[model samples]
Target: MLTAPGSLKAECSNCGATHTPLWRRGLNDKLNCNACGLYCKLHKCLRPKSMRASHGEGRRSGASSLASALSALASVAAPPPSSATPVVEVVSPGVSSAQCYNCHTTATPLWRKDEEGKTVCNACSLYYKLHGSARPISMKSDIIRKRSRHDARAQRSSLTEPPSASNTPGTPSETPSASPGVSRRPRPV
Candidate 1:
């Protein structure tokens, strides 16, 4: 049902994307697809064509079915062990399967102790520390957000890089223009 305007019939100048939710301008005012434009804006370079996805293609593919079939065939073709031994797992005394005191969730990336020395999940502990109160149960979510961490070396190199003439200290371009849907916060001194 979604259709592009007649003027947008041309493919993206960078990634050659024929379809995009939104069109954006890139270097030299060239027409770039949404993904390419965002990538270029963040990295200050054109997006690599290798990262482009085929239209209507998905992450799941025939290769996964072939891999499953091969695994099943291998399991059937292999002989059973001559002697089967019972496997036992030993848990250390210091480690306990404790649930978070606040959220009551058993799973967490890290566990921390509350003011009363009760086990609490990382999120609950951090929230309580920042807000000085227990995190609302209504705010709990099943999905965990993955964050991309920058390498220390890359961070150091960027910090050391000389500022361009347009973005030099005290220049009008020193402060970045606010992008739509993104909030700008002043850095702590």
Candidate 2:
């Protein structure tokens, strides 16, 4: 709330000192105490009786303006909103964005949506199957076989890779060996 000049007498909330408004003419605008030497800030001061009434009137005027604006808005026809309430989009499980809640593994080729709406890997699903926790209504035998083959190939490749320098000490430096009956040496041009 604001007031006309000389209408408000500000009292400090902290020190209980009453002060008249001091309008700084040049570089500063502050109200300083004649008694306690305290500075009174404009926003910190509570609204005076006249100031409150003036602010109340201003608020009423603003409300009337807003009401008039809303009525003006009602005159124009607008297309119906697609949905009254904003639809919260839910991401489907086993999509690229979906991660396993248990293992934090990014699902590849997507997984079947379990009853609890979770994306579970084949291994986890098999475990559940073994435990008789739940059975899938339909099974894809081809996918299961493909997944097994892929896993086996991955395991083999990992095993074939040479141990890192940190893992093996005093081991001879090794490069790729030629295949059986194949020579790596350069042939005559």
Candidate 3:
């Protein structure tokens, strides 16, 4: 049971048992496990509010969420009864038989096992046939594809482009070619 106000239950660091929860002292940061009489070593950061795999180091346990850790500390009751079935009426459909692997839709009129041996629904199968790629993100974006194509063209051009002394960087060309087919000539005298 949590004793201090705003204090949460913490598992015994030594025995790793939730039944023997300990209260942490703010000043010295010591764990007071009354059940096991386990006291955290007096150090700057021996044991933080968050539990860790090892004494002070190793991966931070329950780093994903403190709520999850708290939930784990809470006592869980027994699960409810089973045998809850959903009722559905099949309309003027073909003999609904196969169980889909992907969607898990039972009594599917038409279902087939995928290469990996998962049930695939009829509509899903048709959709997959029309548009490949399981996850949309798995397929390269159109913008990315276009950009890659442009980059490939640029790379080929760069490789094929002969080295020239005129177009060198830092050293500006004598005159900027004003327009195509119009050469820079001396002004009319």
Candidate 4:
């Protein structure tokens, strides 16, 4: 079976999945499939065996999935009118002004609905989902952190490069542990 370059062949101890987009370490440093690892990390328990999918099951190519999502969004955003006359919308007191219910912020990269069907900002929604509690107002910041996406070609090139005589497996290389200008920061709760 074809696999991602630079990825080692390993079976997940939890789900017995041999193919995964990314491999992660789980309990006792055992290798785990991507889905199992993320689920275990979030819930602090093993993923249910029933959730495991068979080979080549429920997999959609990125391009096709993205196209379908865009088309669906377009259809929902602008539906064909039944008549030539334009529809007029009346503002109601019960209607929200697209502001986050939790943080009351009008600006957000994306909007999401909470468990109560209340509108919330992307950060607030994700934070609540992970923590199982409303995000603290004190933690809200005006600045949205920007993350740099590394080029896949550059990473592949680095991994595919041949080992030099001085940089053999036994000998330590002079390169830094992390790539230049990249900083790993802890996720804020």
For 12-48, candidate 3 gives per-residue lDDT tens digits of 4443444323344433444444322432434533343
Cα lDDT tens digits, model 2, 1-189, are 323246465543233334323322111443333212222233544333222212123233667746644664565546556877556467776446555544445643445556687877655566576876653434423343344788899999999997777435555335555565565556799
Top-TM-score structure, candidate number: 4
Better of 2 and 3 by lDDT: 3
Q: What TM-score quantifies how close candidate 4 is to the native fold? A: 0.32
Per-candidate TM equals 0.30, 0.21, 0.19, 0.32
Specify the highest-lDDT model's number: 4
lDDT of 4 by residue, 137-162 (tens): 89888888765556767888889998
lDDT measured at residue 98 in model 2 versus the true structure, 0 to 100: 54
Give per-candidate clash totals. 0, 0, 5, 0
Which ten contiguous residues of candidate 3 have the minimum total lDDT? 137-146
Q: What lDDT does each candidate get?
A: 0.71, 0.46, 0.49, 0.73
Q: Give the TM-score ranking, best first.
A: 4, 1, 2, 3
Q: Which residue ranges in model 4 land beyond 4 Å of their true spot?
A: 1-96, 151-189
Q: Write the per-residue lDDT of candidate 1 for residues 102-142, one digit (tens) a residue.
A: 98887678899998999998889999999999999998877
